[model samples]
Target: MTVIGFLKKTVAVPVALAMTLGMAQADTIRIALAETPSDEMAAFFVALERAKANGLDYEWTAFSDEELAIQAVLSGQMDIGFGTPYAAMQKSKAPLRIIFQLSKLKFFPVTSKKYETLADLDGEPILLHSRGGGTDSIANVIEEKVGMKFGERSYVPGSSNRVVALVAGQAEATILDLSNTNKIMEQHPDMFNVLEMFEVEASDEALFANLDWIQANEEDVQIFVDALYTTWRDMNADPTIISKETNPDGPIGQLPPEILGSLDDFYTAAVKGGLYDPEGGGMKAAQADMEWYSEAGQLEGDPASLNIDDFWYMAPLEAAKAK
Candidate 1:
């Protein structure tokens, strides 16, 4: 071969290999998650572990709160996020869509032994997770039901932090979800009591993505969603599956030894407390959440008018159901 032709062929081969490598690199997806270990994120974590085994490259970003996670997904910093802040979704400039409904958070009004019911919280101080999170929204509903307003409420960013505040008598009452509530009740059964607040079902944690990103990576998106629903089915069928699959080196595995060891029991109690769905499809609870939030003026639009089809893409869930 002529020298010029040989050089041309070598350059073309290297360019082609570079393009292939770039395409492979572009296929990677990043998922963001809130810090809490509720059932809402169980399926995603399971799918992530499975995806690693299947040669799917991905990474995760965990935020201290749901709002931050939602903001990260909205800002395009993450391709997918676990929590769908519905109020933020309605107001964001960039279009976002819910691809999967993970689970509903059944928040309970927990208080010191001095309070027996929501009515007793007429002038009591409350510690909330944050100003406008799931816990705060639930508190709004309780105030309406009991015809009392929360006094001297404070925002403690982490649920564990809020629990600490309650334990140390920094706050007399607070609304907490099942996971933290379980931990608190177990550790100090005599110190606190959970005031049943008629079950506020307004907020659901969902899997969401930017619309443009989903369109750009449809196949990978489909695969990720498929893995998610399959994992959901497996988790709902047997909640212990995730606890069993918890990698000693993975994020869940790296939790404090005490938290890691009690995860199975925690899972069992959460499910029993109606924090998780054994069937994995909690559309009814999701619908109820929409209504409750709308009633609380947290969401501007009509819940009934909001199209369920627009909110969630059921294709992956349907595929998992068929399997």
Candidate 2:
């Protein structure tokens, strides 16, 4: 079985190492990853390798979920992190600023065949990734749109785990990422159903950092963002580029050969599903985020009134595009 297939069977968290991309130094950016290494993050790893090639020094630690990753960045333990921490940013008034959108909110609500639509999920206990993570925000927006609240929310931390729960009959409903959603349906089409979800354009994941750190280390940040911008555009042009450019010794490449072989397939599906923005999701993403998060209850005030500059620092992305 493939590594992900094995993971689905055992519901295990994919292991991640504390990897440093270059010789450690006082200025090495410490990144807080929201989840362990998996196929979902292959493109990001390819970009990281490219940045390292261009003299961007960095290290990363994998947290169990987005909340922990956000806390690490907030507490000064990490220089950058991955998550949509709008609530934390607003409440803490920290100088947290998003630099690039990693992925859009392209999730699927998969449920047992018994539930036909979003309304049928009313009062149903649902499994999700984490308490305040992307899936949690999606659930909140779903409840608001459908005018019905979900019952007890069980946190599982990985989409594969949630898919396992759904397949094993441990969960009646849950949200999943594009690949996992496809995997389960293809494997057991008669067991579950993918509900028709409304379109979501806001970011599901993003690269954010404390403003002070970003200003203090503009060179490194620029290199990182530039590399990401190039990589994203290249992937959108030909998703197979991610699999081709991936460094064999890198985190993503160390996964089982089965997973490595499917990198092209994963990225192709991601791009087709609108999981990424070739432009790195600058102002358009920022505006969409304000509206989506407001509806998701993670941001207060009218989306129009919310100052996007308060959350997104667009200079790096703008500079990258100008090149």
Candidate 3:
């Protein structure tokens, strides 16, 4: 899957920030991030700090979007990336496979007061994060379940920006993550409605890499996954653990005091919302993703017929659980 050839000309070499961690080892793992660092990444950074303490050296570059991050890994420019690159994997038939499930499809369909329920918004224009991103896939499943198709689809990059668009009357219907959804509703409860959405347990964000790379870097990969497993378990048990463990000198900690201050509130809400799976979402998540993505038109063939191992390498996660 030479996705590099096309992207190499367009995708700029992502500027690596001063986010490197651990002792400078001979082999530093290159990580491709889908978005700029923010509150949502605090837990991940905490896990990285844990892995760093265990001698897992690494550096990360923030890509403009998830596609670029996936391409960076697929092209061998980076060893691993953050995203749910199901479409890319299916299209390129690359040996790219997900190792850890970062978060589930916990998005909410928010709309103006003109719509009270999902059915009322039939044939309405909808704003989404990207053409083939998590929001678009959620919209696909919504249409399938609600028995109605949207009128027009528009693309907007960020959930906060989409909420702004809704507030400014640019678009009435859109999907948003838990944090943004809660913010908009709390701020202006009278102006909008969070329509009832069907339950979705599919992987929304995940850590994926090429299988060959995983095999060659098994040690570092195991350390990273083990840290993630432990951090996720601790976060589920006590959501405030993320804020307490955040390094004041790190990227997440460098954000504005407002965001840093609310880390506890955000993570507490996220945990109660069932955003992260304590077990790292190995086989169960792989199976749910097959069904969800297939229904959303990201993958071909029957979901039951698809091989889970083709999209997920579960050994590291299995070892994490064993220990």
lDDT of each: 0.66, 0.86, 0.85
Model 2: number of backbone collisions: 0
Off by over 4 Å in 1: 1-25, 36-43, 201-203, 278-286
Clashing pairs in 1: 202-289
Report the candidate with higher TM-score, 1 versus 3: 3
Model 1 worst lDDT run, 10 consecutive residues:
2-11
The alpha-carbon deviation from the true structure for residue 239 of candidate 2, after best TM-score superposition, in angstroms, is 0.3
Each candidate's clash count: 1, 0, 0
The alpha-carbon RMSD values of the candidates against the true structure, listed in the order shown, are: 9.7, 5.4, 5.7
Over 4 Å off in model 2, which ranges?
1-24
Count: clashes, candidate 3: 0
Of 1 and 2, the candidate ahead on lDDT is 2
Candidate 2, pairs of clashing residues? none
Q: Quote each prediction's TM-score.
A: 0.82, 0.92, 0.90
TM-score of 2: 0.92
